[model samples]
Target: MNQLPEDPCMQEIQRLRADYEAKRARSNLDSAGDRRCIRLADIPGTISGDILRLKQNLPDSVDHGDHEIIGDKVRPILNPPPPPELDDDSEELDTILASLPIVDVDSSKRFVKKGKYKSEIRNLLECEG
Candidate 1:
């Protein structure tokens, strides 16, 4: 026996199927050229007016020539050449120097003895006196 759909899910499926069939029919009709075609009579006069307005809005003179000079005769007074490229040996030397391990030195060993400062301060005081 055929039973009627009672659930919301079945109702939604039926609605989607109807919409799909309607779209397919419209597409087929459009492809068959049965739908209304766009004719010159349908175009408004405002389109021609817009084209004339765009042409009038453009600049009168457009300077599109090359501004840069080439060759030996047109030598640049202040322009400088690019820096020379470093050779492979120089690059390797730089990498080797950069990778070297650094040595930490003790500054306390370089400091003058306390007795030496005491004698210098005494001599300065004596000289002032």
Candidate 2:
């Protein structure tokens, strides 16, 4: 069979195709450690209805010993506790105010004249109010 020579452009394209296939195969092999098959059902909190269904199916008499313990440990991480409440009697506010830089009398007078000192004091106590 007399086969005509392959076109240079077609030869170049075939070579590129082979290179691309090799790279794709290597990429798939390299990504084997990744959770490539993870679905919505596999992720926690992704399907709230399924969780509710599971909870409903479980009998009240059954002890969820390990599950409860795991949930307790995970809950704080998912929903962190609110910061400690600052009351009017809290000394933290006083401590913060005391930590402010102390200016000399002349600068303090200038700040007072421009109402900058009062504004700064008000800003420091704004969160408390």
Candidate 3:
């Protein structure tokens, strides 16, 4: 049986889809190139070889031990001797803190007191009666 001809609209849609896909692929590659990170796989063989050669040429006298660069090891903190002036400074600070008024949160006034409003309402009702 003879195949039906593709609709012109469908053909145009397919063409546009193909063009979009091609553009998307190109943009992905372009964005990948824009990234700051350089993958080891992407590095040129000659450049890697040069790096290896440089590492090999480094003198043994220059300790290239990874352990030499001490990592985050747990150690007891050496407490520094307390300064003689520290006691005086702390006493002054304590006096200043004590001088500041201690605010009583319970004594603080609210914008609208419930008891005051209720009394006013009762007074109004008594006057109306």
lDDT score of model 1?
A: 0.36
Model 1 misplacement above 4 A = 1-4, 29-129
| Backbone clashes under 3 angstroms, per model | 0, 0, 0
What's model 1's lDDT at 22?
62
Best model number under lDDT: 2
Model 2 lDDT tens row, 6-85 = 76765676687667666565432233342221111223443323323232122222222112112212111333344456
Clashes of 2: 0
Question: Residue 78 lDDT in model 2?
Answer: 35
In order, candidate lDDTs are 0.36, 0.38, 0.35
Report the lDDT of model 1 for residue 58. Answer: 13
lDDT tens digits by residue: candidate 1, 9-107: 667777877676665654322233232221111123343232222311111121221111221112222433444666543222343334435545443
CA RMSD of each candidate after superposition: 34.0, 25.5, 28.1
| Residues 2-115 of candidate 3: C-alpha lDDT, one tens digit per residue | 222376765676686667666565432223322122111112334333222232121232122111111222122244333344332222244334433554443212133333
> Which lDDT value does model 3 have at 99?
36
Q: What TM-score would every model get versus the actual structure?
A: 0.20, 0.21, 0.20
